[model samples]
Structure formats: C-alpha cells, structure tokens
Target: MFKKFLAIFTLTFSLINVALADQANPQVVMKTNLGDIKLELYPEKAPITVKNFLDYVDNGFYEGTIFHRTIAGFMIQGGGFTQDLERKEVRDPIKNESANGLSNLQGTISMARTNFPDSATSQFFINAVNNYNLDARGRRPGYAVFGKVTDGLDLVVRISRSPTAPKGGHRNVPQQAVIIEKIERLGSESKAN
Candidate 1:
C-alpha cells in the first residue's frame, strides 16, 4: 500500500512538471541602438497582452520603431513610430488587463494607453522605477503590466535617461530617436527550459 501511494505521488509530480513544461515560455530580445533588453513574457497572467505583443514581434512590426517617449526617472515608451517619424498603425485595441495583479515595478513592461482602459494598441512602456501609482485598483484604471526585464535593465535605464525633444506630435522623444533595430526569440532550447 505504501509503495502504491509513493508511486501515485511520483506520478502526480511528474505530471505537474510536464504540464509546466508544456506551457509556452515566450521571451523577447529587444535589440535597441543603446543595448538589448531581454524579457520573459508572462502569458498565464496577461494572455491577451502577451499574445498581441508576440504577434507584433513575429510579424516584424517593432523593427526600426523609435523609442518615442523618454523621461528621466519615469519610463521609456515606444513600439509605434519609426526612425523616420512614421507611425506604424497597429491592429484594434486590446482590453486592459491591468487587473492581472502585476505591479508596475521598475524594469517591468506595461501597455501604454490614453485615458481609456481599452486603448492599449501596440505601444508599451518600460518602468524606470517602482510605480505603484500605475498599478490597477488605483484612482484610474492602470496600465497593463505584462512582463519584466529579465536582463539588460541597465540599458533600459540608460535609454530612459537619454536626452529628448518633441517629435511626431509627442513630447520627450529622443532627439536622435533611440530605435529598436530588431526583436527576436532567443531560441527554442533556451525557451523550453
């Protein structure tokens, strides 16, 4: 009887491990002119946002897009405009998943939006500091925090602190336009683990 129970426990553990491994581990390598930022996406927590971001990445929509908004000690916004100041029109807006319980912490990635909650459409921001004010359940429905910078956060910080000037009808755009050269998945082997 004890042997049977042990076998059952082992099987359950194996099943749990397999279940976890079967889930897609979406990772993004943001190749910026300043540096590259590696991020591990959380699809379980923010499925819609992750799907949308991955769709854009897969379609090569983020390449050459400039980091259009940069505010020292605030956040870096981008994934919309090109170095030539042309905007990439994105698909329909996504429903705000800010209530996903993710905090807008430093180095975290969140969807950018207007006053409306469902206005997040491709543009995203990287938090420069612990922005508790941007978390859901606040006065305003907060931005949808989806992922965190697993690597290259220093590069993100440096870009956030870069000098800026108004461009494309938006303020705080980097004078030279810090562009995202490319975005790619690291590898299947690395992601599988």
Candidate 2:
C-alpha cells in the first residue's frame, strides 16, 4: 500500500509540472537595431488585445518599422512608422481592452491609441516607468496593457534615452532611428517571468 501511494504522489507531481509548463505565457522576441527584446504577453487577462498583437506579429507588420516616438522617463512608442517617418497602413482598430485588470507598470507593453479610446491599431508602446494613468479606472477608458518585457530592458532604456527632435510635425522622434528588424513568436522554450 505504501509503495502504491508513493508512486501515485510522484506521478501527480510530474503531471502538475507538465501542466504548468504547458501553460507558459506566449513569448515573442523582437530583434531591433539597438538590441533584442523579449516580450511575454498575457492572453488570459487581455485576450482580444493579445490576439490583435499576435496577428500583427505573425503577419510581419512590425518588421522595418522605426520607433517613431520616444519620451525619456515615460515610454517608447513604435510599430507604426518607417525609417523615413512614413506611417504604415494598419488593420482596423481593436476593441478597448483596458478593463482587463492589467496595470501599466514599468516594462509593461500597452497598445497606443488615439483619444477615441478604442483607436488602438498597430501602434504599441513600452513603459519606461510606472504609468498608473494609463490603467483603466471606473468608466475611464485607458490604454490596454497586454504584455511586458521579459529581457533586454537595457536596450529599451538606451532607446528611451536617445536624443529626439521634431520630424515631420512630430516631436520626440528619435534623431537616430531605432528600427525593429523583426519580431517572431518563440516556441515552448520561451517563458515569461
């Protein structure tokens, strides 16, 4: 009887481990001119936003895009423009998922949107510092926080600190473009912290 119980316990433990591993968050590696940044998205919290972002990634929409806006100590916005500051055409806007209970903490990635609240399309931003105002509250529609940077945060800092200047009526545009070479989804080896 004792031997049987031990075997059952061991099997249960192993199964639990496998189940946890199988549920690992979806991760993507973004190779940029500055460096590589690994992001882990929370599909459980913001399913719609994650689906939209993953669609963009799978479609190669972020490739060759430049970090069009950078505000030191604030956030870095990208995935919308080219090296020459030309805005790329994006898919239809997604529904606002800001009520998903995620916060805009430092290193968290959120969808960039217009004042319309549901205007987030292809543009996204990474928070350099905690941005509580971007989190939804009551009836206020805030930016949808879907993911966070799990690696290469230093590269984000460097890009955030890059000098900025007015370009084509846009302020805080990085004088030296920080281009996104590619963004690809990672396999099972990828894990989000």
Candidate 3:
C-alpha cells in the first residue's frame, strides 16, 4: 500500500511540473498558405511583446491576414493587412522592448513599426538572414525581437521568394497573397524539441 501511494504522488508531481514548464514559455503555431510556421516565444526576455503577440493570436487577429511585404534575403512582414489590401484595426502600440538582449538573427521574429520606436501593433516580420541593423544599440531604437521560427523556415523562404509588386501604395506586396489561415498557441505536447 505504501508503494502504491508513492507511485501516485510521483505521477501527480510529474504532471504538475509539465504543466508549469509549458506555461513558463509558450509556443505558437502559425498556419499560412505557404506552410506551418512554429514559433517559440520568449516571455522571459520580452514579456510585453510576447504578451501582446499572444493576445493577438488568442483574439484571432491574424486570421485571414496576408504577408503584405516580402523582401528576399531580408524578411517577410505580415499580420496587419488582409488579402484584399485592407488594413485591419489593431490595439494601441506597445512600448519598445528592443533592449531585451534578443538579436534579430535569421529565423527570429520581430515587430514591425513605423518611424516611431514604440509604434508596434500587430504587424511582425521574420528575418530570413542576420539583420544586425535591426538590433538596438547605443541610442538607436531597434525593432523588438520576441520569438523565432522553430519550423517551416523553408516555407518562410518560399513566401519571401514569391513575386512581389506595388499595391495600394504599398511596395513589395506579394503578387499572390500568402494568406495566414490561423495562429494559435501550441499545446505543450506540440512544442518543438
């Protein structure tokens, strides 16, 4: 009877640990027409940015969005415009978290903002190559790096390589819009190994 009780306690402890581990750093899966892009967000590093992004995902704000801008060898930007070039309303811009010690390296995802440093809303970009210029340094306010693509990087490349043209005064718009089907928080079991 003592052995049985010990086994039950051990199993319960293991399950609780797993749940806590998954909650610490969340994972998200972004399904696009091109392919599935899995991301591992760093809430510990960029807490505000990660929270904003996850809130957007949870609210279904990324559904039916398109990759509006894709610059080969640079990055692919999306999560703001629709397939018909219509801009969607987003929450107020969050504070700049560029000094979070995260670099805009290849496969890393960063927020896309206007000239204002703290004007990042729902738009984000995935770096196709090392983009050191986007990293905060000295007095420069660089884009905030919050997460990275753990899978479907080749799909990101494919979308970046797609034909682009000017549309609705927006340059580098993909001719064939790569629509974002949906983005959701990945289950703990689905996290990247």
Candidate 4:
C-alpha cells in the first residue's frame, strides 16, 4: 500500500511541475525605441503561435524590424522589416491557432495572417481596443491571439497614436512607420543584481 501511495504522489508531482513550466515559459519582453513592452506568451493556449514568435526571438529575426502598421484605436504591428522597408525572411508559415480560446481584446497580441487561416509567419500585432469582432468565431477565422501586453499598454498606446507616413505595401501600412529597432528577452535570472 505504501508503494502504491508513493507512485501516485510522484505522478501528481510530475503533473504539477508541468503546469508550472507552462505558466513560466510564457513570459517575454519586447524592447523598442518607444519603450519596453513586456508580454506573457500563452504557449499552452496557442502552441503554434507561441512557438513562431519565440522562434523569431530566439533566432534574432525581429532584431531590426519596424512597426509597419500602426492604427490609432486599432493595433500596432511589427516584427517583419527594417526602417528602409526591407523584409526579413522568416521560416515557413505557422498553423493558425485562432481556435484557441484567447480573444483579440485590447492589449492582446495576435498573429498577422493572410486570407488563409494557417499563414501566420513572423509578423504580429497588438490590439488597442476590444476587437471581439476579430475573434476566431467571426466570419473570418480571425487572427491568432497568442498573448497579451502585461505591463506596457501605455507604450503600445503611444506607438498607436504616433504619426504615420504613407507607404506602399500590404496590410496595416502606417502613414508614418515606427521602427522596432530590436527585441530582447528579460527573465528573472537576467535581472539579478
């Protein structure tokens, strides 16, 4: 009986550890010229989206991209280009996890996709308003919202309100583009003084 009880305890402990790891793996930081925007990724909720974003971060794919699209009261997008509008080649597209229960609410981060559902690559956006209409259940499959801005909504708002410059391109073209400059990760271990 004691052996059986020990085995059950070990299984329960292992499950708990997995849950904690999932929660801990979601934290991320976005450093921009405007300011630093800290995000908490939801790999458990949207594994594909999280993996795509983290892959870019890990490979330094977003190092010099610019926020090509910024619409006040709508969203701010980046992670795809340089100040001169040069596209940074990214890995093949990722599966759209829009079916995930997350919403495209204000301050939430979502993947930028084409007409198709599974076309999201390296580009992403943050909603400046509660965009329930963009949720997956809408007529369109909707953008894959994988995370949210946890501590820098003000920075996002500021970027959204910045003046835009006219540019010829595809979706969310800002009249005046905001350059991303770079993206870096900040964890507790790195913060130790």
Top candidate when judged by lDDT against the true structure: 3
Superposed Cα deviation of residue 115, candidate 2 (Å): 0.3
Where does model 1 exceed 4 Å of error? Answer: 1-24, 189-193
TM-score of each model, in listed order? 0.84, 0.87, 0.85, 0.81
Ranking by TM-score: 2, 3, 1, 4
The better-scoring model by TM-score among 3 and 4 is: 3
Off by over 4 Å in 4: 1-23, 138-140, 170-177, 188-193
Each prediction's whole-model lDDT (CA): 0.87, 0.91, 0.91, 0.81
TM accuracy, model 2: 0.87
Weakest lDDT window of 10 consecutive positions for candidate 2: 184-193
Could you give me the TM-score of model 4 versus the true structure?
Answer: 0.81
Model 2: runs farther than 4 Å from truth? Answer: 1-23, 188-193
Over the stretch 68-185, how does candidate 3's per-residue lDDT look in tens digits? 9999999999999988889999999999999999999999999999999999999999999999999999899999999998898999888888899999999999998799999988
**Number of backbone clashes in candidate 1:** 0
Per-residue accuracy of model 1 over 33-117 as CA lDDT, tens digit each: 8889999788889999998988888888998998899988889999988887788899999999999989999999999998989
TM-score winner, 1 or 2: 2
Model 3 TM-score on a 0 to 1 scale: 0.85
Model 4 CA lDDT for position 22: 56
